[model samples]
Target: MTDTRKSTQNAVGAPGRAADGLAARLVVERGAFRLDVTLTAAPGDVVALLGPNGAGKTTALRALAGLVPLAGGHLRLDGAELDRTPPESRPVGVVFQDYLLFPHLSALDNVAFGPRCHGASRAEARAQAAAWLERMGLAEHAAAKPRRLSGGQAQRVALARALATHPRLLLLDEPLAALDARTRLDVRAQLRRHLADFEAVAVLVTHDPLDAMVLADHLVVIEDGRVVQEGTPADIARHPRTDYIAHLVGLNLYRGQARGHAVQVDGGCVVTTTEDLTGPAFVAFAPGAVTLHRERPAGSSARNLWRCEVAGLQSHGDQIRADLTGELPLAADLTTVAAAELDLRPGATVWATVKAAQTHAYPA
Candidate 1:
């Protein structure tokens, strides 16, 4: 119901405010759940919708592509209304989460299908499809069936199919969700390169913070079917407004009332922050900033220390991450050798300390 176009402005593309792109207000209802989100992207911009599962990210994408009709609000591309346009008729292309390549068709045929549907002659469609496959570096697999192609190759074919239509707006739904860890890295890099080459407006839905940060020009964080936060990836990572985002960014976050350098968290402990913020404030710090000791230290300069019991521990890359709960619930990262020397494990009591300067405080 709110028109946030004027309020939620970020520096878009080189064209500034005059650039042609997508501006959509999506409203849909399914029984008790209602999704209402406003999205904007200028040409040459790649916007990533980042959110938890069931937060209506995919529904918003479907609404824009006309796969699902809007119960209310409007859909526009450039300056044209497309609320009534069929999925195939709109200048929008989609790369579905599953890739959704036809099992019976060859890679070339699959990529050519979109063009063929738009009245291109078979020869023309196939020629365009071939060019796209070559661009994707999958020209050799043109004759291979979907089953014969690797996961990364199939993903490229799906992208090629979506781009072959010459759409003004591109929608990608969890484009790398299906790939394995190793394949995802390569596919993600390739996808980023292709996205950079695209000149139109593109919107992608992803729950991974790293994916959004690496692939998008702007991040729109959605929660419970509404826009919770919107900004550049760096801005969001530095100052997360919500606990979910903080967790996603791998930081321990707390909301409290701040007076001078101290913030009284709702739970019990008072966190010392570098900034002197007032009223409602948030304190956040990375796990790496926390130093864990098996016994209390005698002459530590750390202003914030918590006597916590290790609730769990896990391997995070080359470091060990410890989950602690007591006076202040937080996570700490230590080297594997340090973890071994400290003999850290579940239910171990430890002292955690963080310097005041390491904690960041901002208006909530």
Candidate 2:
């Protein structure tokens, strides 16, 4: 309910702003794939659509950009209904997975294409294009063709072109995906800065948890073409609704019953919670929340503690991921230094505890 038009103009500033701006709620259908998503992105909000393959993530993005038809739902931007609007008619910019720059055109020319198509003179388009390239730190590459540019440079050129259009909404489909692992880290950092500077609503689709966690302020987790969960990165990381989401973020979640911020597990063990939900519910704790010990503490007042044996171990960052099998299976992450101190290894007996504050519960 803010003054969306004025907000759009101020957010994108001069370089990234089009005439007005965008908001979209699109429902699309095709063969066996159906996408029904509702999104309200502000001028500067970066909402990430995350899911596995075939989860209709790209389908929803396509619908919003007008590349795909809206079988249902309506898209609005700057107070205009765009569900039936042609892709070109909507004030939206899209950067595809691959930087689809024209091989024959110089970076500046490619960036100028949109302004030209919208009826700007060649000189005017080139003027605007030059400024955008300079803003992206690609001023030297303005005369370079697609093949002459590095992957990250090409990506910036593509982004410059997209923003040059002055779109109210920007859509990036796996923007950093084409880069290799090392390149990905570099580009991802650069992309984060670019996205932060973008004033309008920018939506990105990615299967990478790190990408979603790092780049997006809000995440919409899709599975089987439906939104299974939507929240901030911390919320999703701490309280995953489904096992798939849990595994993606490397957490463990269990559904059970809760009575006053406490949940009873299937094996008669009770776990404390941080939620107020009653009746059937879910209790989640992160792997880092579970501290492993070689022996149970004699005078510990911990609410939920278990003695288990390590079934597996894997390296996760600077820490060790210990997979334990006992009354109920659990995964715990501890520093490599801690593991070394405990002398923990596969088949080792360990004690795990869940601090009451760490256990989160909500209605299932």
Candidate 3:
């Protein structure tokens, strides 16, 4: 939490910044899926590639690590081009989602494998692995096999193994995805500290927003193999440009053209806001700002009201989220007690209203 979030302005250079980092334009082609992404990171920066499943997040990481061949584009690290380099030959290290520890090898040997492959002597590699294990707080589990170690312990060993080579680029694909929620929190904090201390470019791929926000200095959101948005966590969270991003940040978003206080959404209902906006604009509001009534309320001060039917309802923490469809389709958050009092259910008719002041309008 102490690490400052960096701006994602240029993927290549920044004013007064060092050049010893990663800069890559990756393009990969499969049967139908294509991933074309531009990525950059500073020496002490941690970048996170975040998106939904099958959104080319992992493909980007693979391209960076040389696991997947690039159809076109360049990859450079520390001012050296590495587009044609092999995975092992490149100064890159990878921690896969599954941990992928060697089943037959002990923890120490697993951590030492990379050093040994890089031409270090057996004794030297083991000694270096022991140091890494101790750093990861896993020295006691050095003799344990992959199956014998806990999930958290195995994850640390994998990280230690990847770092043993001291690569310039560190790539992690869902680093904490294999662990349970409780263990994930613990490991995530540890991983954040490790990544912060790493004096090289680190790129992590994850679909979890919390993980992306917590571990990285900048976030690159990809969808359908394209870079949809890139910025610091706060920037992206506050001003999401796409519906996917709006959903991720828990906002009801609509694109429209504004005239004075009225905005007519494309293919959706019109929204009225207190802010005076003109031309192309977007309207967004939190679910909690929406007020639902069983019957149309008379003399209500709210300017926007829609007659909708409950399409679906689900529990969200202590509140309930209602998906409504009609003049305006939106998700609204309601307290459990209020939901029960109204006997809210699918197909039920409800009048939803939002005060003009609650809706935020901004230029698209």
What tens-digit string does per-residue lDDT give for candidate 1 at 118-187?
9999999999899899889998999999999999999999999998887789999999999999998999
lDDT tens digits by residue: candidate 2, 1-364: 1232234343224653443345566788888777888887767778999988988899988888888898877888767888788898888899999989999999999999999998999999999899888888889989999999989999999998898877778999999888888988988888887777777778899989999999898899988878999999998887788988989888778878888877887677677866777788878788898988898877777777888898988999888999999866899999989999989888999999888887777777
- Model 2 residue 51 lDDT? 89
Model 3 misplacement above 4 A:
1-19
The prediction achieving the highest TM-score against the true structure is 1
Each model's total of backbone clashes: 0, 1, 0
Q: Looking at candidate 1, what is the lDDT of residue 362?
A: 95
The best candidate in terms of lDDT: 1
For model 3, residues 1-364, the per-residue Cα lDDT tens digits are 3243232322112122345688899999998999999998777788999888899998899888888999999999999999888887998999999999999999999999999999999999999899899889988999999999888898999999998887788899999989999999999999987776676789999878899889988999999999999999988887788999989889999999999999999985899998898999989999999999999989899999999999999999889999999998999999999999989999999999999999988888
- Alpha-carbon shift of residue 80 in model 3 (angstroms): 0.6
In angstroms, the error of model 1 at 25 is 1.2
Error of 1 at 125 (Å): 1.0
Pairwise TM-score winner, candidates 1 and 2: 1
Q: Which whole-number lDDT from 0 to 100 does residue 313 have in model 1?
A: 93
* Candidates, ranked, lDDT: 1, 3, 2
Superior candidate under TM-score, 2 versus 3: 3
